[model samples]
Every structure is written in C-alpha cells, then in structure tokens.
Target: MNLSRPLDSAGGTDDSLGGSLAFGVVKSERQRVGVLAVLIVLLIAALLWSVFGPVVMQPELREKVRASLPFGIGMLTVMFLYECTSFGWLTQLIRKGYEPVYWVRVVNAVIEPLFFTAVLAFLIVFVGPLNGMAGPAPYIYFPYLALSALSLSLRLSLVSGITAAIGFNVAAFFAVHGLEATPSTAVLVSFPHYGMKGILIVLTGLAAGYVGHRLRKQLGESLKVARERDRAVSIFGQHVSPSVADRLLHQSVELTGEERQVCVMFVDIRDFSNLAAAKLPGEIVEYLNQLFGPMIQVVNDHGGIVNKFLGDGFMAVFGAPSEDLKLARNAVACAREILSSTDRLVAAGEIPPTRLGIGLHVGVAITGNVGSEQRKEYTVIGDTVNVAARIEQATKQFRAQLLVSDAVAEQCGPDVAGAVDLGLVELKGQPKPVHLYQLV
Candidate 1:
C-alpha cells in the first residue's frame, strides 16, 4: 500500500511516508493561494474606506497611511499571482501522481511576510518613524503565519513564522535609526518591546509546525490501517464464510496452527472421470460448474465453507473456523441440502444427471496455514480429515450417497441418530473398523 512516486528529485513530492503526504501538501498550497486573494480584496477594501469614508487624522498622518496603500497593494498583487501559478503547477503534478515539490512552498513561506515589511518601509518614507516602528503594518504578518499551519508541515510553518519576525524587526530597527536626531524619539523607539514581539511570532511558528506535523502523521496512520484491513478481506475471505472471515481478520479467530474439535465434510462427484472422458474439456467444465455453483452456496448457508477444491470434488468444513459448536448438525444438514440441490438441477435439466458421495466426521484436527511463506494455505490436516475422505470412498461400497462416522452421528443425536447403521467397516489404512452410518 506504500504508493511511492518518482517526483522527489524534482522537489514536487513528499516521499517520507511513501508519497502519502504529497496530496495534503498540494491541498494546503491551494488553500494558501485562496488566502492571498482574500487578503488582497481586504487590502483594497481598506484603501477604499480610507479614500471615501470620513477618516479623522492629521493631514500628514493621513497622507502617510494613503502612501503605504499602493505599495502594499502592489506587493500583495505580485504575491497573489505567484501563488495562483504555483498552485496550478502543483495541481497538474498531483493529477499525474507525481509528488509535489517543496521549493515553491519554501519560497512562498519566506517571501509572503516581507510584503507587510514593504508597507512599513513606505510608512517610514511618508510619516514620523513612530508609525513604522510601532504600528499596524507588522500585524499583517500574523495572518499568513497562521496559514502556514494549513500546509500540514512544521518546516513550512516555522519558515513563515521566522521570516515574519525577521522582516518586522529589520524594518522597525531602520525606523529607529531614522529618529536618531530627535530627543523625544528615545522614548518612542523601544527595542525590548519590538524584540519581545519578534520572539512571540517565532514561538507561534514553532507551535503551529508541531500541530501540522501531528495532523499529517495521524492521517498517514489511519490510511494505512484501512488499506491493510481491505487487503486481508480480499485475500482470505474467498475460502471462508463472511462471518468467519470477519472474525478471523478482526483477531477473534486465529489462522495460525492450533488444535480444535471440528466437523469436516468431504464431497466427491461419483464416476466423474467416466462422465468427463467422452466430452470436450470445455463441455465437461461447464457441466461441473453448473453442479458445483449452487452446492457451494448451500455449504456457506449452513455455516460452512468450501475450504479448497480437490479437482472433481471439494473439501468443506462446518463451523467455518472453530467457533461453532453446532458444526456436526450443520454439516449433516448441508450434505442433505447438497443432495436435494443436485436432484433439482438434474430435474430442471440445468446439468447432466449426477450422483454425489459425501462423508462427515467429527474430531480434533490441526487446522492452520500450511505450506511455504510464498505459497501458503489454510487447511485441516489430521486423522479426522483422512477419515472423512475414507468415508466418502466407502459410499460406493455401501451404495449410499451420504455417510457419517459414529462420532458425527452421536454428536448430532436425534436428527442424525435415525441414519441406518452400516456396521463396523474396515476402512483402508485404519488400525480398527470405524462405525459408519448411511443417510441416503
């Protein structure tokens, strides 16, 4: 799920979390561009208010504020245009799945605060140095500094904050130097006041950066968890009941090897080789598909899963994982349903006339993921599994469509107790004969 893009060298992407943070960066830049436009509109509105509305001030002070307006507006206009173009470029890169570069963000962060400094410079040129050193011009830096947090990047936030502090202090210091000859200017040019203000701006930048970084980190982790959950469901859900699949994935059921009592069912198509021998491969495949499709649904409906296909037949297990105590009864019900379903298929002429052999057994078996790391399988492997297969084979000798070991019959009691006893049958490779019962 790590979606890495090759835009890092171009400085157009964030590859730190495998390009996960790139989209957020681009989205933040687009928002910053909109902020610039709003700031310009507000500046123009202030200019209009100053020009047309009744504003009381000394003629020199009024001219000073008016003089700073054009300079401030022009600088903002240039910055806005630059930001709009940069946002467009980042948008283009993102559409192509490239990582957006950081240089544009880096440049914008450092340069944007200096626009207010330019307004301060114009104030020094047109008015007494007091307005430049201790006035409203430095306040403009705070808005953009606050916006740096929207980038979800601590570095960019800090850069914007630091630039604002440096630019404001430099402009204020120059204004103080201009008042050197004035004896009254001594009280007005306070270094500690300006220095304390600069420190607070830098601290604000640091705090904003920390918040942005934390937000970005949380987003990355949440995306990872969701993707991993989807992957598990996609890969493992096919072979199990949906309920079982959910429990296994959510850690309620373990996939690792463990001993659990289960009811195992093995189903085999009778004389399938002879039936397939005369037909074309495709024809035979279609025939098998028709028979098996509904049979699989029957298994799933009975709290079971067709764990794996064994060529002409498949092995299904009831209880799905190991949580159901009713596995024996469910497996018995599923076998009878499969038999009824096949009858309906043949009756409707949906498939060729077919016969089935089903065997059910109940016992402790080792169930878990088996095979190599690259090619693993979830399965049951033990005497219980072997006995189930053997019982399916004996169905031919007994002339029965369904058979169950005494263990399964006993477990299910009344529902399965009526099964006709087939006597102690000596199954192949068994040390002793197993009590078998016929259901068909």
Candidate 2:
C-alpha cells in the first residue's frame, strides 16, 4: 500500500503551506496595527504638550492651534478605525472561512504608506510651507517605512517607499510655490537639500526590502519542512517512531526522485490467514498491533524504516530515503532481531503464538517520491523489491524462518557466516531460478 493524500470537497489538496503563510500575514498585520497605535500615541502626546505644556508657545502658532488640532485628531481617528477594521476583517477571513487574497494584502501594503502622505499634506496646510516640510511630520514616514519589511517582499517595500518619497517631494513643491517672492531660492525646499532627504528615505526602504526578502526565504523553507513532517505523521500514524522519520530527513538525505542502491526486506506472518480465521476482526487487529509495534521499533533502531504496513506484515527498506553504507548488513541484522522479538512476545503471551518469514536482498532500485500532484509517496520499486517478496514466499517451501538472496548473503557482512546455502530455487512467476540462503 502507498501513502495517499485525502482530497477536499472542492477536489483540492490540503493547503497546509498556504495556511502557514496566512499565519505569517496575520502576524505582520498585527505588527502594522501596533506601529500605527504607537504613532497615534506619540502624536497625541505632542498635541497635548503644544496645547497645555510650554513646548511650543510661539506667537504665530497659538491662533492656528485650534484650527489644526481638529483636523489632526480627525485624521488620526480615521486612520485608526480603517486599520483596525481592515485587520479585523482579514483576521476573520483567515480564521473563519476563506483563504487570504493576495491582491487584497498587496493593496493594504500600498495603502499603509499613504497615511504618511496625508499627514504631510495636513502639516503643510497648518504650518508654513518651509516650516511644515522641516517639522516632525516627515519623520512619521520612518516607522511606516520600517513596517513595510513585514511583507517579506522587496518589490512591495521599494515601491511603497519610493512612492512616498515622490509624494512628499510633490507636496513640498506645491507648498513652496505658495511663497510669492524668492520661492525658487528657498533653501529648505531646494531640490538639492530636499532631494537628499528623499533619497535617504528611498535608501531606508531598500534596506528594509532586503531584510523582508531574506525573511520570506527563510519562512518558506521552514514551512516546507513543517509540511513534510506533518505529512509523514499522517501516513505513518503516531506509533511510527521519530527515529524512522529522522532516517528519511537526516543531513544530506533528501527524498527526491532518483535511483539508488538499496537493501529491500519483505516480512510476513507465516500462516496468517489460518491464524486470523479463528479470531474476531478486532482481536486480529489487537494481535497485529501488539506483535508489529515492537518489531517496527527494532527496524527503526537498526537504521531501517518500515515503508508501509501490510495487513499481516510490513515492507521495510534500508538506504533509500537515507544513505546507509551498512544497508545490507543493517537489513540482515534487523530481520534477525525481529525474529527474536517475535519469539519473546509470543512467549510472554503479549500476542498469540506465531511465526514470521523474512527475506532480504540488496540491489539497485528506483526509490523516491511518487504519486499525483495531490498524493505523494516515498517508496522503493524495482526488481530487487520483487525478488525480496518472492524470497519471503519461498520460506514455506524451504521450511525456513528467514531467507536472503545471494546478493544479500554476499553484502550483509558477518551475518552470512552460518547461512545455509539452499541452492538454486525456482521462485513462482519468475523466468529464472534464484540462488538463496537460509538464515534461520
């Protein structure tokens, strides 16, 4: 049996990665809200100081305060409501029903920077052209610029940053023209001076973009790893040990498509059909669970993985998902240990008395991820696998508990020392006879 993915009602595969990405998006949105809240608090503190405290009591400013304060407060309120509501809507969309829309998120990224532009315009209208351009209003862009990095997109950050700079310079241009005399010669809004500030803002955005780009790359890799891990757990069940999973993903061992030299082992319960017929289905399942659980652990400890469980037994592999120089040897060692473990379990009365037949062979085989776009499986399939299964069946004919092909006998290290040569045995459905050795 192969691992298969469950299809959704819409005929789509589960979008685990997309769900993870949405989680990241939610975090960024929350951060943006924090940034905006901080800005509002700072603005409120500045207004309170100017209106009550002695920070700014300039004769020219006192009369203009009342007019400017209402518009400033209004702008802040609108910004707060817009962002909080948008954030709420996005959070609900992700948490409740639909997948996040890309264009909607991108639009939000574009709109956030525009708030600073509105603030700049407000400042120009309240304070004089030159004074407003030089005031803290322009500095508000800094926090907003930094917030863009949360998108983990360089292009979005750069576009948002550079666009704000141009908008600022444009507002400055129109305001400077408000002066009737020497407007062109005004040094504060001069192209050279103001252009340098604009350049600095653009540069800061570029840096933030680079940071976001790096973060995006790292997050993608982390999500991919998490998806693979969840997939493995889904296929193998909770009883499958981590050691078995680790073998498939240890350093330099990727489960990509390729041909590799592998040791294939087929294990089966001898006379399982006869034994199962006497018991209820539930009892059969319980017996199999009790018997196979520890045997699978033995396979894991010996650097082999039970690829998939058959009704009565399992097919295990060595050196496919992970490279093992001792693959043939490990497969041989693992098979012997399983035989010992089975006898112990039966004697302990943990499971009904039973017998197992195991066959091992080492040869080149095609091993990798296979299946449809929605369903994928990492498995071994080749002549070596076929021969190994055939050998397991031959065990009853030869009256042996375990058998290994000539290739396994040669490559399986010291385990071959006492292997009894069974000579050429013609396996069923095979064109030629196979040389076999009995280990038990």
Compare the candidates by TM-score and give the number of the best one: 1
Global Cα lDDT for candidate 2: 0.76
Scored against the true structure, residue 412 in model 2 reaches a CA lDDT of 68
Decoy 1 TM-score against native: 0.55
Please give the lDDT score at residue 351 for candidate 2. Answer: 83
lDDT of 1 by residue, 217-279 (tens): 887787577657766776667655465556555553334787888889999999899899989
> Each model's TM-score, in the order given?
0.55, 0.53
Q: Give a tens-digit lDDT track for model 2, residues 1-440.
A: 31111222122434766556556655665566666767777776776677677764677775566567777777777877787776676556545534344565666666766776886788678876776787777887777778778877788788878887887778778877645546655677465577778888888889888988898778878978888877876565444345444444443434466788899888899889999999999999899889888888888888887887788888999986778999988888898899999999888988888999998888999976666555555678989899999999999898788999999888865778988999999998778999999996
> Candidate 1 — what's its lDDT?
0.77
List lDDT for all candidates, in order: 0.77, 0.76
Which parts of model 2 are misplaced by more than 4 Å? 1-12, 97-100, 178-185, 231-440
